[model samples]
Target: MNAPRTLRAALVYFNDFENCQRFMIDLRWPDGVVRCPTCGSDKVTYLADDKRWKCYAKHPRAKFSLKVGTVLEDSPIGLEKWLPAM
Candidate 1:
């Protein structure tokens, strides 16, 4: 998102749940192509209900979230706080 006109506006934007989720989603899939981090497969399906992406490849660890493979992995804190604090 473009820089807000004020710091308060930035805070308001980051506090929004949907906006934060969108930001994380975009950050995870910067190229607009969602791939499985485990198996390196592009045929992944977004399971919004589960808040994670599932790979089409047959594997036990076929699901991953934005936190996976990053420093934020397994973080219980939501992105609304974690991302902004980063």
Candidate 2:
């Protein structure tokens, strides 16, 4: 989905977890392929329960969330709140 045009719209649009996730995914991986940020590998799977991605290839940091490798990394803030502020 397109980004909200106004500040109020963004606040409403990004309130939902699913909408925030999809917005971040699209913003991060515009091509629709999620990859391992550390290894640059595309062989990854999303763990719905965990709300993160796991790289199948053996690696030290196989599991990653949307915040990994980003300014949001290590922050406790949720995307539902962060995305709208961007």
Candidate 3:
């Protein structure tokens, strides 16, 4: 019944996870520490195809994306749409 509420919900639903991830990464690791999100270890490797980082330290979630351990978990959006939204 409320147009504004519906629009707000739609926007939230359309949030871009990749862009959110990159943004969060820049915010958290501006100097490009490339640390493991799960274990806080600087030992990490980038997986370009999957866009994720792998940690040398063994953990439940050794591999993680830029959005891992952030507010954008489980989102299915892209950076192209997310930058404008922000």
Q: Give candidate 1 misplaced runs (Cα > 4 Å).
A: 1-7
- Model 3 steric clash pairs: none
Give the per-residue lDDT digits (tens) of candidate 2, residues 1-86.
Answer: 68899989999988888898888789789997888998989999999999989999998999998899899997788887888788
Highest TM-score against the true fold, candidate: 2
- Displacement of residue 19 (Cα, Å) in model 2 is 1.3
Q: Can you give the TM-score per candidate against the true fold?
A: 0.75, 0.92, 0.65
What would the TM-score be for candidate 3 when compared with the true structure? 0.65
- Top candidate when judged by lDDT against the true structure: 2
Which stretches of model 2 miss by more than 4 angstroms?
Answer: none
Q: Estimate every model's Cα lDDT from 0 to 1.
A: 0.76, 0.88, 0.66
